[model samples]
Target: MRSDYFKNTAYVRKTAVSSSIQKLDKKDDELAFAKFFIERLNQFRKLNYRVVSSDEESSGADIYATAENLETLNLQLKTGEPGLERFWGRRRKLGSGMGIIDVNIEDLLAQIIRDSEKHYANKENLTLLITERYQPVFDKNYALRISTMFGNSSFKGIYIVKLPSFRASFPYEGQIVAIKDIFGNHGEVF
Candidate 1:
């Protein structure tokens, strides 16, 4: 993938999001991967959830995994992490200018919460917007892009995650080696 051609480093940007998903690269493939990931999560059972869409929010979580599993809790899954990193540290590197980051994540987060609530309210189903998380190939804390929005307030920030961190948290065993590499030298399993 083209991501492989780039440096291992990660970047945090305030790039705008549009009403359409067409601008997103390989969206179909990404959705497919997200669905597959949701399936895997469901195999763990323990929780009953489904993939839901909110016209108000626009963005669809990989899965709506809900549970009383206090440890697991309720979550909205993203192909990548959802909460963003703070860009307060990047201001110094932008030639001592104003903050380098753009857009307020906190504001965006609020919009999501509002939309999520209003969406289900019409259906007469009470659903709490518990938490949002991302699933990335590499480091999570320092992912290539830590996109986030804090609801209830207009404050927002984004930060960059170094490559080294990504390498550490990446689900290597899940993707790097073939299924056989793990189950070992055995033949295919149906």
Candidate 2:
């Protein structure tokens, strides 16, 4: 009985350690993605955006950016597999492949809606940007979906930026797409 108890305890301990490691890996990936996004955004000569802070624990936003116009772009960076569960407190594994990722529109919208309200309250001309790693595949109906979810809010816009793999690349090109009605106009591509 003593040996069995010890074996079970050992197993539980190992499992807990493994889970903790996985969470740390996810957080590390998120931070890496945030850094990559900031680097790419900075490449645009037209925009002078600065990274205010990159603290992982900051609940407000992963990274905060400000352009020359003094327009604050509160950015939340997420990198993971595609699923609605992602918006509801779940993290998916990021594949190494480089290509367009078909992200869940509803999930992304849900996150934007939740974060914009929670983070960007009272700030005018505030842009609550939710940037996802890799390309997010969305359809024409995405505009309507966003409009329905937005309701009444002070958030000026929600921008989704996708990009190539965060590797030393030969060529790079990316854009930030705004959900049309959610912002009332098209956002600039960086």
RMSD of each: 16.9, 7.6
Worst 10 residues of 2 by lDDT: 83-92
Candidate number of the best TM-score: 2
- Compared with the true structure, model 2 gives a TM-score of 0.51
- Which candidate achieves the best lDDT against the true structure? 2
**Tens-digit lDDT string for candidate 1 (87-111):** 3334335553332334544344445
- Count of clashing residue pairs in every prediction: 12, 0
| Tens digit of per-residue lDDT, candidate 2, span 149-170 | 5534466555555556445743
